[model samples]
Target: MLLRMPGVYRPQGDTRLLCAAFHDANLPPGGTVLDIGTGTGAVALTAARAGAASVTAVDIARRAVVTARANAWLSGLNVEVRQGDALTIAAGRRFDIVLANPPYVPSVVDVDARGPARAWEGGCDGRAVLDRLCAAARDLLTPGGTLLMVHSALCGTEESLIALRGLGLKAAVVSRAREPFGPVMRGRADALVRAGLLEPGDIDEELVVIRADRAITDH
Candidate 1:
């Protein structure tokens, strides 16, 4: 079991989807890994258990860092948990595999707002963090590297594919699962419907796992 602190994102369907996708990923022996927005280090621990050479998990929440670190210790997995912005922490480093399960729930809440909501609130369009991660994927990855990311279809899976392909990477959705709205999405259902992002009475969201790969010949 993983240890999650208050305010840290709980390991839900999206997290499970990402973990399952990671299992099917082409992780070379001794490949290095970076897990962005890792909450309880669940995905990071999975990589480590699979024998990744190194696993570094980053989250903006201090509580998450603590929780992840503790979980790593509890599980006897070697994961370097860091508390900082994902982009900033990933700067100057490249990994063979990048795993991301960032916030994708659209909301009027400020992306910078503090508190538990930060774990799932993804700004007005739900693309705030998604866009940033896509834009930075190339820089964070080594040539031939692959990124496995999970988010709600409400966040525009097509947009993510376009962004990665535009950056010269091969991108596609590799997994998907529909799930009933959780508390957060249930609360935003009306607003999303009013904004035309969702149909009236819609109470389910599709979670998708996208895989993007850098061509080995690129560099």
Candidate 2:
């Protein structure tokens, strides 16, 4: 069956990449999967199609949840999309596979509260959202379960790796792509320049896709 996801979904490109990467990792069939920041339910639906028995998708935006559910129904995929922050979801809820394409757009400028919550906004240095997600992922994963995340290279990839390792999660770079800076970063730079956080000349930036996995250990 063809998969249908929202084109406007933030980090849509990375979301698609991570979904394909997880499938390629040979995750056990019929395992429960969690897709954090599941905009459009792409990764969650992909996991379901790849033989996950249950897929739970969570997002901070209610509209994202609604859109994800609609996409799931349209694609005939069974996925549970919930409206809640990833950090505050049900405690003790564990999954065999946890996947995320978080916001990695670092900015010195303040974000607009009314703006669409792009899944990839990393604060200041671009690791804000990623830090929260990685920390929470430690508790959300089951023994022997795996966590897959896609992030940008400019967002201090080394720091992110160290953070995950500090959390006792084994990390690796599974895939990467070099792309021009996204609008978030560009806009952030503009805002920062106006606010004196950055110079007008410091606008060009590069993006990379870094995938990390958390290895589950047996007690």
Candidate 3:
């Protein structure tokens, strides 16, 4: 799957999460898993391959949903891919583990400008999407369930911790990559700087990846 989709970014494909989910962590054999923003369904499929009993891959973009479903079928993995915004999706659904590689790019570009692709934009300072996801994640996770998210380091680790705390989740940096901002992000940063939404020096490569978990307290 990674070989076929070289352009799309899949955080679950990251060595850290893959290694941890498969080799490091104690994922119960055949447990259920959820992959938020399941681009190409790499993570969800991988989880299924790793013995997850059920995997649901959700994405906001119709194209992403189609691509993910196609990939799942080609891989012969039983993954359910659906098109829905994470923020407005129905509640009462919970999972043993939830994985998200949301758009963490902070920019001033209006989300409507990019249409459906805006699902990957993190707004100015890059925490807009992250903030919303964290809030919603609290209700989606089962007790003792894990929530893994990949985010930019430039957004401030402390800030992310704070946000997670607000949602009753604990956050920690799971991996760091000095990745270059993509073309769309580069242009957005420049425009935002010109518009005074960001400082010129604030634009640069950033460390990306924050894997978090929701605590489970027994009664």
Comparing 1 with 2 on TM-score, the higher-scoring candidate is 1
Q: By TM-score, who's the top model here? A: 1
Give the number of the best model, judged by lDDT. 1
What is candidate 2's TM-score against the reference?
A: 0.82
Winner by lDDT between candidate 3 and candidate 2: 2
Tens-digit lDDT track of model 2 for 1-219? 333344335545576678777877777867998888887777888888888889988987766788789888988889988887776774679888888877676666666533364655567777788878767766877777777888766667787778777877777677775455456656566765675544577745433444445554443
Worst-scoring 10-residue span by lDDT in model 1: 108-117
Model 1 residue-pair collision total: 0
Minimal lDDT window, size 10, model 3: 6-15
- Judged by whole-model lDDT over C-alpha atoms, candidate 3 comes out at 0.68
Better of 1 and 2 by lDDT: 1
Candidate 3's displacement at residue 1, Å, is 4.0
The digit string of per-residue lDDT tens for model 1 on 22-73 reads: 9999689999999999998999999999999999999988899999999999
